[model samples]
Target: MGARGQGRPVAVIGAGAVGTSVASALARAGRPVTVCGASRRIERIEVTEDGSTETWPVAQATVPDDITGYDTAVLAVKAHQTDAAAAWLKAVSAPGTTVLVAQNGVEQRERVAPHTDGAYVVPAVVYLNAERTAPGRATLRRVGRWDLVLPDEAPARALAAELSAGLMRVGLEADFATVAWAKLLGNITANPLTALTGRRVDVLRDPGIGTVARLITDEAVRVARAEGAALSAAHAREVLAWLENAPEGATTSMLQDRIAGRPLEYDALTGAVVRAAERHGIDVPVNRLILALTSAIHPGQ
Candidate 1:
């Protein structure tokens, strides 16, 4: 604990690529960190530039019971898995434990709020594209800072600094809603398109496929505005530009889930846009089609 004030251990709820990365970052910073989840597999991780490499053990525990005594918990599970993760947090952690959500989409904080006892729920919008290449190996596609959006209050800033210090680069944003919506704008396009077409992100950026990407992003931008998230058209344009410039070999998480035949976070990424469109009384025809296509591809999801 660097600059510590009540040093409760840090727990990462899911040891997937994102969870492992966060846990490794904290553990590298000399914090007491444990990763808890149902997966019993052990993983060997090598952290970036910090020379932190360790064999990470995944603790076995079921939902709503496994979450335990850590002062800070980072929920890095997929968006659809958030409810069960929240329930676990409620059963395990004491009140006032900070819960940081490191998932895609904008609804994780809201989803986790009902279960936890008014714990400081920090909604983080992740930017780095990390993937589980093997059981214990994950590769980082982007080396970017983690952006955490919380109130400017002392507690929030202090928590941000504590979580960020000596780990990955962390930035505090006053308008967190805007940051989340902007990240959502980026995620909404690549994920669904890649899942639906079974194409890698590079292939999806072709002129024909690029049009579909634009359509989905445009609809998400509209919904973000309707929800008062303060995103702009330029954000949507930038999303497209990023897609065009992204590594051709890169595959979205949705694509990975589809190939593995595991449940996808469709409900959060693309399905979220569809729900938001209905809420705003706006037409999201392209998004609806993408959702249908992706869902059809994953039948029974």
Candidate 2:
């Protein structure tokens, strides 16, 4: 179960874009990794840099009852899929298993805690812009690094160091809350706006769309402030400015889901904002409108 010395058996629960990318990086680092919860068609072509891949032929990928004897389990599934994935973790994971959550949003640890049996749940903020171009192939749009937020534990730091040594950059930050909220602010601007307008990130450069992007950023900043997360107006503006400079054809994941007719993460991203606004006793009409529009388009949730 343990990787003698520095090596560890890593099981990636989801073989989506993020999951495949992380599994590749871990394999490149000589960490024995296996990807589960994907179709055999994808599994056959799920080639890591080190040429290691496994096809988990299971109907419910979130169920971990079939997965066994892995040191670390990385949950790269969607936010809504976390509950089912956690149920599987509880069934299969051992006490010493380390669960690294590489999904977006700030509440992943909370969502997975109930299903884990005393496993260390480490929250991580991934910064790579990866997209699945094919069933098993993912294109790395931006080779950004990963920022990890770990509990005050030595084993967590050791794990971070090992993963950081891979291809992309990796860093551990003491103020994990700030790091997470910062990424959320960026996501708030790019995701919902693209989903609502059916435009790419560069659409923000248009003066009319730019104004809406600013509004979204402004509301997110207010909610973050109300949540006691230290995010400034300047930070929000910086996020908007970055979107303005992004590629003209850079569509967000939400937009991509819309094109593919899959369920979007509107509830997790924009819906989270509404919940946060309620907690702060602040009304975010702009984000509320965006959320409503996106939800209307999908109507799957």
Give the alpha carbon lDDT tens digit for every residue of 149-256 in model 2. 454466567667666665546677777777778788878778877777777777778898888878887888889888777889898887777667664355677777
The residue ranges of model 2 lying beyond 4 angstroms of the native Cα positions read: 3-7, 43-63, 143-155, 247-249, 299-301
The 0-to-1 C-alpha lDDT of every candidate, in the order given, reads 0.69, 0.70
What are the TM-scores, per candidate, against the unseen true structure?
0.86, 0.86
lDDT of 1 by residue, 98-171 (tens): 77788888787677777777577877777766677665456655533453455455656766666566356567
Can you give the lDDT of residue 116 in candidate 1? 71
Which pairs of residues clash in candidate 2, taking residues 3 or more apart in a chain or in different chains?
A: 64-88
- Please state the error at residue 238 of candidate 1 in Å: 1.0
